[model samples]
Target: MPFAGFYAAAPFAWRVSHLASDFAMAWFKGWSQKDQRRSRTVLLSGVAGLAFIGVTMKRVPPGHVGLIEDWRGQLLPGMYDDSGTHWVLPIVQHPVSVRVYPVKKKLVKEFTTKDGKPVEVMLQMKMAPKIYYVPEIYLRFGRDYGRSFLEQEGAIDVNSVVSQHTFDELVGDNADTEDIVDEIVSRIEDAAFFHKIKLRDPNIVFRDPNADDDEGP
Candidate 1:
């Protein structure tokens, strides 16, 4: 098979063909026996290089950012790659992808109202890391930022707002549901902002705890 054909069989064959062509001329060169052996060595080394690139090269899909980290778990700052192909060093470095698009998260918590009533609250929100702060976000919160920061911190704010309202102000026919949801979202947005996450249109649903009670109303 042609040398290009050999490269064509590699995992990222289509992508690596241009790379293989750069060194392939060595195989067709006129040389003495010793020089031919040297050429073979160089050609083999080129193949190895191509393989290394195939293994280390990473492609960050659309709407995502990629970061590089070493085996020691250290991230290289200011070197994040936007959507496209990039090379991560072999063996010593690997790729970490963080989605830049909004991610929807649902949080359920039981909170005690000012009237001491237990209300099951379901909060749903869409959030995404600020593009410029993605590296810092990963550094501080790691890849699971949604769970580590958003959910944990957001829950606190949610409960705080819920605890301030009486059961009638939160869930009954007299409930000011819109105002309460707005307050919860406002508090969560503040928390999310400090953590470098952008929150959008957070919503809440309340289920009456007494609805499931065996006793008749």
Candidate 2:
């Protein structure tokens, strides 16, 4: 009968079904491996691109100078100017900023005049580090040169110069205060020159010696 042949064909149909299922699984496994390789390649390329950008880019602000230091902690020879972007070696070198604009420093101190009279003086001066000597300045005073060197040494010079002058010379209308100011400025200038500082206009205000308060009215 035709119904008896159906059972005979069942074994052959089962073999064909099993073969198709095995082939499908093999194709899926190969496709997954290819996708994994592609993903790994993309990840590595992105990391390399970011690392390249980090090493080659630098920015210096306006009215400033950039100093480059190598991995050995030695400053580079050339001075970088202000307000521009620059390129430097990543991880091998770094940049430091030094202000090129004038920096104002003030000193208020009490000193004895030539006549043995005690006087109070308030002095203000503007100065900046020389562009060429900035690296040396950094090496010596770091980034705080204004407080570390300028204010400290400038006060000492001012006190020294004021001690040599009479009280009347500073406050008397007939006396030439400009000469006294010039002398003080010159001495500070000489001291600062070695430290890479350049001096600008200096202003002085004298307080009444008899006043009890430090900031005399």
Candidate maximizing TM-score = 1
lDDT of 1 by residue, 1-217 (tens): 5687667677587567866776565555666779878877987999898898799778886778888989999988755456468878878888999988998878877889899999989888788999898888888888877767756887788788888888887887754788888887888888888878998767788888767685776
lDDT (C-alpha, whole model) for all candidates: 0.81, 0.79
RMSD of each: 6.8, 18.4
- The clash tally of candidate 2 reads 0
**Candidate 1 TM-score, true structure as reference:** 0.73
Model 1 clashing residue pairs (backbone): none
Off by over 4 Å in 2: 1-31, 70-74, 83-94, 112-118, 166-176, 209-217
- How does model 2 score by TM-score? 0.64
